[model samples]
Target: MIDTKELIDSGDLELYVCGALPANRAQEIAQISKQHPEVLEEIISIENAYQRLAAGLAPDHNDETYAKLEAIIGAKNKVVKSPSSWSPYIGWAAAGLLLIASGYFYNANNETNEEIVQIEQQKEFLETENIEIESINSQYASTLQVLSDPETVKVNLAGQAGFESSNAVAFYNNEKNVTYIDIQGLPEVPENMVYQLWSLTLDPLTPTSLGTLPIEKESYNELLRIDNAYDTQAFGITLEEAGGADAPTLERLYTLGVIDKG
Candidate 1:
């Protein structure tokens, strides 16, 4: 029930990538990413970005530099007896002050770099979200146009004998040779079975298959578009095996509707 898009937009994924998220929260994200491919893809993209950033900013150093750095650190750690002169003491104090200032500026610079990375991530997310929104809006507009067309015929499919509660609606446009079915009221399909549509010819009692409905539960309420150029007198939906049947299974019929020629 978690909204993946909202989670991605919440900036938690970026924190997760940076290892800044709490252990429990990080594990939750990991589990969700397994269930949702888009989330996983985003996580990978963020990691790649960080890798590229690190590669670009990392200082070039070899074993010799590391050895030199270790020696310097060892030298600093050696006990130094207090000198009689005040001049040396003043010089040591000045060096300590300079070190503190350098540490402060280095921390500030790191904070600024982190902020830049976050801003870039936000910009990318926004652009992606905007494109998805535009694509969805365009689809809605097209669906509205098809439903509003005067040539489109609306057919209501009532529940069959055993399926008293199942219902669905279909918008068929003969001129456009397209059909969209709204099956929001249909019951959840059983496992290993699929809902198949049939375009019927009453005169000869013939049924032409119009393909199968998607098995996704999330898509049940959405309008399912099917190509139907057949001269159909009635429409029927039936539960069939996974790959669907060569013809409608009368016993498994869930909903039925007849078109009015008059």
Candidate 2:
């Protein structure tokens, strides 16, 4: 027979009883108990002894004792059923909902403020662009006045016989010592060539070079500023070489005018 105390302390017997031992170890122990009947008898005897000892140590509980315990449990359940015990939980739930609403409102307000700031910035930018446009309009108005003044002498350069319908006007201001020419009616010059203006003195038929007109489709329609003042009798324009003209090319004169520089 195996000592029960020694077998339990071996750890192997405890693992075997708990079904935690390896299959090989369990088979070995089973084979030994089968071959030695004394080991199996001792195992059965130890189990029966433990069961009997547990039954003897338990305290006796009568029906009257159980009834009293059940009554106490039923009373505790009645207290838990009262509504006042649940008030704190309800308060916490309401507080959670309010916090969520406040968070949503705060985010929405921030988004609205951001949109307003962007609109204000756009308005400011548009206003600045408007001011620049207005300033440019004012400058153009002042320049137009200088070209249309009555005291300014007007010279109409009519197209020559071969080049009919090509006309231009020159506004000369003697006091300002400047001439503004409107070459809108003139045709485009051939490549590598430009239009040149001249002041002609009728007595000796002298031609003096004024200046070359800048080339572009709309430049001819705009007012041109000329440098020199004149007491000339006529104004003339011709298609000359680009840059400027040296004297006047009479054969290439496209338009001419008799100016009454009074």
Candidate 3:
């Protein structure tokens, strides 16, 4: 079976949606999409995202202004002849001057249009970049607030045997019933596997799954928020199959931590 996660992360789906992939490659993607429903879903998502962005960024055009531009570009210059003895020379001279002026203005207008297009493109690019920066900054600010809050409980998960260097932190908010796990110290997860968080109860050694970590570039080292209302006394992270297992795999456990009651 093809690794759908790997294919999605490879960015081929985005290229396919943008119609940037070559014919053969696009055909291959189409064939694969039939075999893998997830790939087809990703392609649709990319197309929807692009459509939303285009709708938000598209400039409005005025019909009157458009018509004026068409008129200016399509109108032909005419030089009327004077009904006098020197009509021939005067008409020729006037026509020559008119032609020269028209050519100059036409070239200047085209240059101006090109400049306007370039400026608009640059402005759009900068706006997109600014939005991304603001989003990242907002996330960082939120995470910092949670970390600094007095009521938030911070648990440190130490690496397990054979994975002594790996570590992760969980910020638990009792009031909000939310837990944000910071996996910055953890190594990159293997493509075929995923990292799953578990909330543990010490009395009977019960474990509750908290879903699998997302396998995206932006998700790496980022604070992942999980909804947790469980009365967890301990937390553990384990490496599991792509879709995650119903229960924690004991042997594949990477990190474990016990909440301090004192």
Candidate 3: segments with Cα more than 4 A from true spot: 1-92
Cα lDDT for residue 214, model 3? 85
lDDT of 1 by residue, 1-262 (tens): 5699999999999999999999999977976786679999999999999999999998886767765776778733322233233333445778775776576566666666766776777799999999999998998898888899998889989899999888888998898898999887687888999999999989779999999999898787468888999988889999999999998999999999988776
RMSD of each: 16.5, 45.9, 15.9
Q: What is the lDDT of residue 182 in candidate 2?
A: 80
lDDT of each: 0.84, 0.73, 0.82
lDDT by residue (tens digit), candidate 3, 6-62: 999999999998899999999778767865789999988999999999999979866
Window of ten residues with lowest summed lDDT in model 1? 75-84
TM-score of each: 0.62, 0.50, 0.63
Q: Between prediction 2 and prediction 3, which has the larger lDDT?
A: 3
lDDT of 2 by residue, 84-143 (tens): 233344457777757755665666666667667767777999999999989868867865
Look at candidate 1 and give me any clashing residue pairs: none
Compared with the true structure, model 3 gives a TM-score of 0.63
* lDDT of candidate 3 at residue 170, scale 0 to 100: 92
